[model samples]
Target: MFRLAALFLALSPATAFACGQPVCLVDPDSLSLTKIITFEGERAGAGPGHNIDDVLPLQGATFGEHFAGQSVGARGPHDEVSGDAFAPLTMMAGRAGQNLSLVHFSGNTVLNGYGSAGFPKRDAQGEGAIAVLFDQDQSALAFDLRGGEDGAALVHFYRRDGSFIGPVPVQPTGEFAVAFLRSDGHADIAGFVLTNTDPQGLALDSLRFGKPPDMS
Candidate 1:
């Protein structure tokens, strides 16, 4: 039960990713993100499983902030098991008697449906983006994301073992932010301010456990 704010960012390369911002760049010396993956949870042999789509957005774009004004039908937390892009089908076998199957659709509806959440209230749209970073023999990832307009933002963290660690803190900037964590346990976090003066504004925000660049 880790708690991060609604504006923090996340990085997950174990699965394919898409972003709404152009700031996320791959270091090239790391792995590559190939395809976008979708996951559905299993219930008592009925009911639809939780669905989650990953979105990476370019900087300076305002998305999903409108959803903040109202409750949405497609809002919820997702377990990595039910519909995670990085986990393989074989991992589902660990669960008791329940059988999990992967459904290959032409594309993910949840990830692509952010546009319909209503605007001002604008639909959340994004392009696929992936970047990789490494720490010696181990690997880590970085990404830029944008939830649909009004859609609250969140940052989730997990260890290399596929276990949940927690969420990070997010600034109350009213826009999205990107987070980068190195395998060595250091992070550099920042976000583009959602304003008119410097439409493409950027700030050298804070880190969880290490020194970050001066924001002044």
Candidate 2:
């Protein structure tokens, strides 16, 4: 019986798990979502600007664009961006809403195993972290991330009232990787913070939020 159990465990797919916490699935496509933010559209300035607060409260299936033309050094903090209240999806810098930058990538830039033109980068002060708030409460969340050459990052879950839940580490080979986290039980996932240690910088794109297929 012991050997049979061990064999079953070995044959099972690897997953990041913890007691009373969410599970990190290896594939983002495993979860079906109703909406996705691609971050592609118009901008206020010719180059990367600071304190981008114009685009928010996105309506319908409309896709939001990032600020363009700013130099890499001039990238500043981003204001809170969100979808409609019905299916609320908001993204900020820190838990307390600190400032972060939205970067425009040109040339050969790839994230989550695919080419990316622009996306939000981690805040330098926050130590490569971005906080996301889900007003509607979600059972699952997924996004594309690009860590430094070393490739290391984590997803910290939280409740609606700003209570800590648990964390899942994401270590993908190469520069681009995708991360997906789904609650083990109900739709209690209120928010999550993604952090990376890449000194070269961290990038995020293609954020998806919705109920998991397996959940009732």
Instruction: Note the clash tally of each candidate.
Output: 30, 7
Compared with the true structure, what per-residue lDDT tens digits does model 2 show for residues 21-66?
4555545544456776655552322123232322233332221221
Let me know the TM-score candidate 1 reaches against the reference structure: 0.25
Error of 1 at 44 (Å): 39
What's the distance in Å from true for residue 216, model 2? Answer: 10
- How close to the true structure is residue 161 of candidate 2, measured as C-alpha lDDT? 52
- Candidate 1 residue-wise lDDT at 71: 20
Tell me the spans in candidate 2 whose CA falls farther than 4 Å from its real position: 1-21, 42-98, 107-127, 172-177, 212-216
Local distance difference test, per candidate? Answer: 0.23, 0.44
Which regions of candidate 1 deviate over 4 angstroms?
A: 1-73, 76-152, 173-177, 182-216
TM-score of each: 0.25, 0.56
Please report, as a residue range, the 10-residue window in candidate 1 with the lowest summed lDDT. 88-97
Error of 1 at 136 (Å): 11
